[model samples]
Target: MRSRPELHGTNGAVSSTHWLASAAGAAAFDRGGNAFDAAATAAFVIQVVEPHLNGPAGDTPIMVYDAAAEEVKVVCGQGPMPSAATVGAFRERGLAEVPASGLLPACVPGAFGAWLRVVGRYGRLPIADVLAPAIRYAEDGYPLLPNASRMISALAPLFRDEWTESGATYLNGGRAPKPGARVRNPILARTFQRILDEAKARTSNREAQAEAAIDIFYEGFVAEAIDDFMATAKPLDSTGSRNAGLLTGADMAAWRPVVEDPVVVGYRGLLVHKPGPWSQGPVFLQQLALLEGFDLKEFGFGSADHLHTVVECAKLAFADREAWYGDPNHADVPIAALLDPEYSAARRALISGAPSSILRPGSPGGRVPWVPSFAPSSTATDGPDWLAELGEGIPAIMRLTASTGDTTCISATDREGNMVVATPSGGWLKSSPVVPGLGFPLGTRGQMALLAEGHNNVLAPGKRPRTTLSPTLVCTDDGRPYLAFGTPGGDQQDQWTLNFFLNHVDFGMSPQQAIEAATFHSEHVPTSFSPRQSFPLGVSVEDGIPETAIAELRRRGHQVRVTPAMSLGKVCATGARSDGGVFAAASPRGEQAYGVAR
Candidate 1:
């Protein structure tokens, strides 16, 4: 039984990690906008209300099914490393790993440009309509979330002592404000207003306005602020030392959001689409390819046999991620060979009745595999309980103090068969110091890069990091738009969504049921975050899972970490129904997540 009923509508549907953001999307639909416009609008609003989880300077990978083009496109909103960001530069600094939350690992901010581009290219409404909600929330005020408050409170000492700009933007007289207090960022509001003013001055056309807006952010005042801030700001990071960032105004002007085709795999008649190798998305497809061999429905939903098979497959797929997945523009990722049926079959042979402790990424196409190992991450005993829940977006682990990273999700669908889903993350309040005047932080995605030279994901000038911000889009057997869904868990994104997809397709569960159902994931492979912690033979499960399965998992040598019920995932989904209607559903795990349709 689902805790909340799935919302159905003949007009449009919206589901997001936050209720306010979903409501903002619904408002966009009421304004005669399509799914892309609704989604972009919601994302901007998300940047305002969920500041602890995401900021405007973060990354956003969007999956859009445009009814006009009759094609699905993946928007690469992840920014590349700065021109000065090189392995040699990092090594010269005497750093083995990129600092977690500082300017040193900074990259160009990508969310504004990506959102504007998606809406400008396929949306019906004007750019101003898409940005108004976010601007209003920033200018006026919105109720602070408990999570955001906790993040601020936990980092209060750091903010007061070092990240004073962050303290100015988020704190009340150098102290973290209470949850539910009215929070305002007039500077952020003014920043967008300036962009809007400049864009309107340049163009009267809606589409041109979008392009003009993008230019303003990347090449105009916003970029100038970022450059100025990074030019002199020395702030504390995961290294426990203050460092300047590498990102410059030139890097901002040089980078642009690219629209590309998504990597896809067929699963039980549905075409499952995920972002390219630049993201950890194809790992989800790899899992799908392997699971196609198993009769999961016959294994029964949430059964010990089912969970074991999924976890084992996750280990194999993620092992490949750690060894191979990277920006294809910089390196050759054997994605095609990795997804081949023969390769999947050969890898499937590795799964047994018992949990496997070995990390195994298959040698696809006779290529050698190499996985990096790292020291354990530092955790503060006094940190908030939500630390692990914060998806490992921007990584930098601190042993002596505290550091964290997180992200959020947005999804929308309309009656016209337009669908869009995006995972906007990075630049969390705890990720980096707030850029002065911009009221946000530069993303530390470069931290995901490895110090190991010649590695697929090694730090390099102008190369995109292998991001975990992946969103999934699905199509019917006939190639028509079906569904869009994603969550805000770093390494767990593919694992959690893979389980949810199986719950929907294989076990015949409804969308709401699939999201609310018990979830499990294996952290057996090395994490993408700093310190690169790995848990060999480990599987984390919701307490909602059958105790029998837990005991069985232990019996099979699986070290299970049982978490509180309804605490694993925060997935949101919007999909098309066969009867020409649309549906939306949000995970009950995040009380703020909501689904609305009209």
Candidate 2:
């Protein structure tokens, strides 16, 4: 039996990475808002409650399935580098790779635009109404989470010495607030209120008002403050050197979020949808394609055989990610050929009973993949600079302590069948100096771009960084939406989501059961953050996995590390049921994620 009863409802349902955010979404449903409205409401609340993980200035890539249109679409909220951001500039700065923490890695913020896009086109409530929960929480205060408090305290020294604005904003009496202590962000509340005020002054039309709010973020005082701070400030970075940022007011005005068709692939009679090449989402499709060749049921769930097969496949898929994935607008992505049935069969042949430690990127469509040269950040004897090694950046340090990396997810399903999945991340508070008076930080998404010449993901002017923020939607053969799910683990996002999906579809687990299932992830490929490192044959499995399985993995050339049970994944999901009831589930790992339905 599933450990928890599935959350059932007909009116609506919302699952988010934070309990308060979930409650905010349920409040939207109570106000007669649709899934789109509820998701937007919860997204804003996440920024308020999980400030260390996400903020108003972060990037969010959303996947939405419109019941009316019977179609799934992606909102490309992943931001691009500024026109002045170039490889030459970094070279002049005497940097080998992008610094994990600094303004130099900042990109145009995209979450606000992505959220506005969804609510404007598919929502039933006013912009003001949808944002009310977040505003209230920010102004009135909410109890602090242990994770947030811990992250603040860990970076307290850096904030105090280098980014005073961040210290003043996150610290209470020059120290991190104790867990459960009430925390308020009056300035952040004012920042959000200013957008609503501008929108109300523009017009009474709901869509128009949403557009007005978007304009204020991109072209009004919000943009001005970001530009002023970036133009003058040179805050301490990963290299312990103060550096200026590249983003300008013109970049914000010039950029706009676009609606693109999701990349669709078939697996086990279900059609899966993921974001385009701009995100690491398509890797999930690649993994599924490889696994399709294997009879997973024969190996069985939680078995040593199953663990080895999946880890080996992940290494191959992620190896290709480091070589070929990038912004399709700038790079030639061979999606059609990469997902070809024949190509998948050829790749599947490489998987064996034992694990392979080396990076193995496949050539698709006769196009050679560009593998990065082995270049470590510092002249250290260690193999690669893992997240723990990069202790200077806030994101790396936070992930090292929390186990779950930076980011947050929100999923909602309304009575009308509309479903939305949004993953908001980037612009981590530790990555850049907080914009003065704005009460939020700017995104350092540009750090994901490679510095190698001629590589598809090379850092360049006006190019979107290949981000790790991925949201997924699954549908049946008849094109009916089945599930909307996602999580917040940087490189592990796709891996965790993939495991959760397989648990539900292949193993016949309920939504809650799938999220609670023993989880494992491979870190065999190069990481997405600064000081990028690769573990030739590394696998991290939860303690729940059988000891025999762990021992077998070790004997098979895999470096296995067991973590605490329920400490691996933070997935949140909402799906449509055959009985006309909606179901939602959230990970119980961090005690922050929750799902509510009624």
Q: Which candidate is the best by TM-score?
A: 2
Candidate 1 structure quality by residue, lDDT tens digits, 18-83: 888899999998999988888998999999998887788889899999887789999888999999
Number of clashes found in candidate 1: 2
TM-score of each: 0.96, 0.97
lDDT score, residue 482, model 2?
A: 87
Task: Name the lDDT of candidate 2.
Answer: 0.86
lDDT, candidates in the order shown: 0.85, 0.86
Per residue, candidate 2 scores C-alpha lDDT tens digits across 1-598 of 4555689999889999999999989899888899999999999999888887888888998999999999999988887899999989898988787777678888899998889988999898999998888999999999998877877787777677668898888898889899899999888899999999988998999999998899999999999999899889987666656788899999999988889999999999999999998899999999999999888778888888888888888888888888889999999888888889898888899988788978889899988877888456721233223223323333655556646858899999977789999999876666677899988888778878878878889999889989888899999989987899999888889999999998888888888999999999998987787566668788999988999889988987889988888878689999888777898999988877999997
The C-alpha RMSD of each candidate to the native structure, in angstroms, is 3.0, 2.4
lDDT (C-alpha) at residue 394 in model 1: 42
Q: Which stretches of candidate 1 lie over 4 Å from their true place?
A: 375-405
Model 1 residue 179 lDDT score: 83
| Candidate 1 vs. true structure, TM-score | 0.96
Clashing pairs in 1: 100-396, 103-245
Q: Superposing every Cα of model 1 onto the true structure, what RMSD results?
A: 3.0
